[model samples]
Target: MYEEDAQLASQDWSLHPLGELPGVDSVTYGIVTPGPHQPAGVPLLQAGDIVGGVVDQSTPRMIDAAVHRRHQRTSLIAGDLVVVLVGRIGDAAVVGVEQHGWNAARSVGVVRFTEAGQQHGISMWLKWWLKMPEARSRYLESSAGSAHSTLTISTLTQLPVPLPPLGFRTRLLRTMRLVERRMVLNTRIAACAMKLADAHFVRCVEENKEAPRPAAVIADVGEVVGGMRRSAAIEDGLPVAWAAPAEVLRHRLAHLDRTDQTTWAPPHAVCAPGTILVAPRPGGVETVVSRIPLVPGRGMLALRVERETDRMWLLHELRSRSKELVSTAQGQQGREMSRKAFSRFTVAWPDSAQVREPFARIAVPLHERANTALEENRVLEALITTEFTEMAEQTKGKR
Candidate 1:
């Protein structure tokens, strides 16, 4: 047992290895050798599916029912805590009510708590505890492997957990549950806002279906500028916002009001507010392009729209036709689109300013609202992090 675990165990609270917990019915890994993926079958949950302490059922891989049956021990149901046992070790998410009848990937571990566990809020407590920095560090220290680290069953079984008094646990659970509920509500609100914007954009486009489509090659509408190759040593550049391909992938501006100047490099391409950013490389699932204008940092491309063009309209149109845009990308490794190719890509251009005005008027506000909700979620996340840190400190001081 770790010294910290011993210290906590010596206190009034009981400390037990995870496997010995009476409420925990089972702690097991998923399918060892999954069969080839299928277009439609049983939903197979992987480590990546868990994001923001919840299972993201969107875009899950599937396997045959036979394979799922073969891995019955690892079959997931609601109330189970799924932990990433490989790569991003210690990341966990609870199998939600809607996520029943799912099976886990080899990279994930399923912790199924008993009815007593549910009554005691074991899953809820475990989810928050596993996310603590100290817990994560301990897990990392026990994990083995070079290129791809993994958590062994033995290591997982030996993991220690603090079992405080039931009353204290209940109060803590209630507080955290309220905060989590708010966060979940905020996320849903943000999603609905974005969906509303998309719907409005579609309606606007459909309304102008009868109008003549004045098409323009992307090159004609804007200047396709490539990002600079950042220097290895950044001892000489001015401090500025730097946007990377990852930020573009996430459809968000990178380093907002950030102070890190080391990543900021020159050619210092300042992408204006209306400019569209494109990820020439293929890796992310969320459209390979975005229009969240920011200073183009490293490994990204920016499209500076012509002054007369409708930037919002263009953004919506690109997003609507993202599949075609992704298909246009060339190259074998990493599959990237060049500036020349981007320049030649053609899109429907609104014939009149009047036709595009409605979209901008309605869509902009909806997007703004969504962005506001996202920012609120970020603030909430920061607060939760602080709370968790303080809680850990207090628990440590109890010794």
Candidate 2:
């Protein structure tokens, strides 16, 4: 390596073998210190902490306080960097104030930057580097030996990192942080908007209480519909906007995939867009009834609304009764909805078309908002992908 590269070879901002990095320390596990159920004492870092390249401090398991007293050596500080040492290993994050209750173990590591050359921008810079596609390539190359695959501290320390000027690193971190802040604000706004939509829907329903109604009974899958066949040709084809059972829960009509899917041929006729999709098999299982709209993969039912009923109104009604619907499925099939139990399910519907106009007025804005949100997400993903790719390429020559 050239003289300029020598200084950065093993530290932050330098492209050197990670093993040569200064101040490297491996993680020690809490197993030897104490075990769970002893008492809520010290917090423990697990492999799950680095999810999608982010340290979710919320998941750190709490150890007995007594354990902390014994394992003072494993204590972590806010500036320390933690890395996963087990499955999917090598994922790393900077310990934040939120991690005060936590300490590293044998399965984790706490690496500190060398005192002589540590920079404030180093942490965020390293984080951004780790998220780059090139870094992932390096991680996969090092972890190829394991079936579950993991990055070791030794391997991570050996990976090459670009040594951009400290100011540049700071600029990059600021830009990324701005994006993150905006994302959080958007999330809050989206949540509040959704709540407003829900409240409006409920108010409209209550106001129309005196309208003429259709004769249908609200029932769970186990009460009326039977389970359909599970076999279907799964496809990723685009489905037209639909108001199916899933729509009732999602509160938005979106396309379902026809391709990349198994063909679900239910014994009873499949319901149309204005119908409900009930879990015929069961609930509480790791199944996605809400993600299915058109034809469901077996053990499901499609409840079509009567022509006189408004699709949106029926959807909101199902949403209001979601808890009741899911609960009724309990004790049916490991907490699932059975088809035989859903056959008799019915609901009260207005007999006239005029009753649906009110629902239509309330649904228009929601439909627009859903479409807007989906488009915004697609655009954001594209923007992030482009920006990250460009940055990684710019740093490629440095490495």
Across 65-96, the per-residue lDDT of candidate 1 in tens digits comes to 99999888988889999998875677788898
Model 1, 122: alpha-carbon shift in Å? 1.8
Q: Residues 110-206, candidate 2, lDDT per residue (tens digit)?
A: 5655442244445545555665677777877776656545666566777776655455655666776775566445444544555565577677667
TM-score of each: 0.75, 0.55
Give per-residue lDDT, candidate 1, residue 28: 91
lDDT of 1: 0.68
**Model 2: residues with Cα > 4 Å off, grouped in runs:** 1-13, 16-63, 67-99, 102-119, 138-160, 208-385
Which candidate leads the pack in lDDT? 1
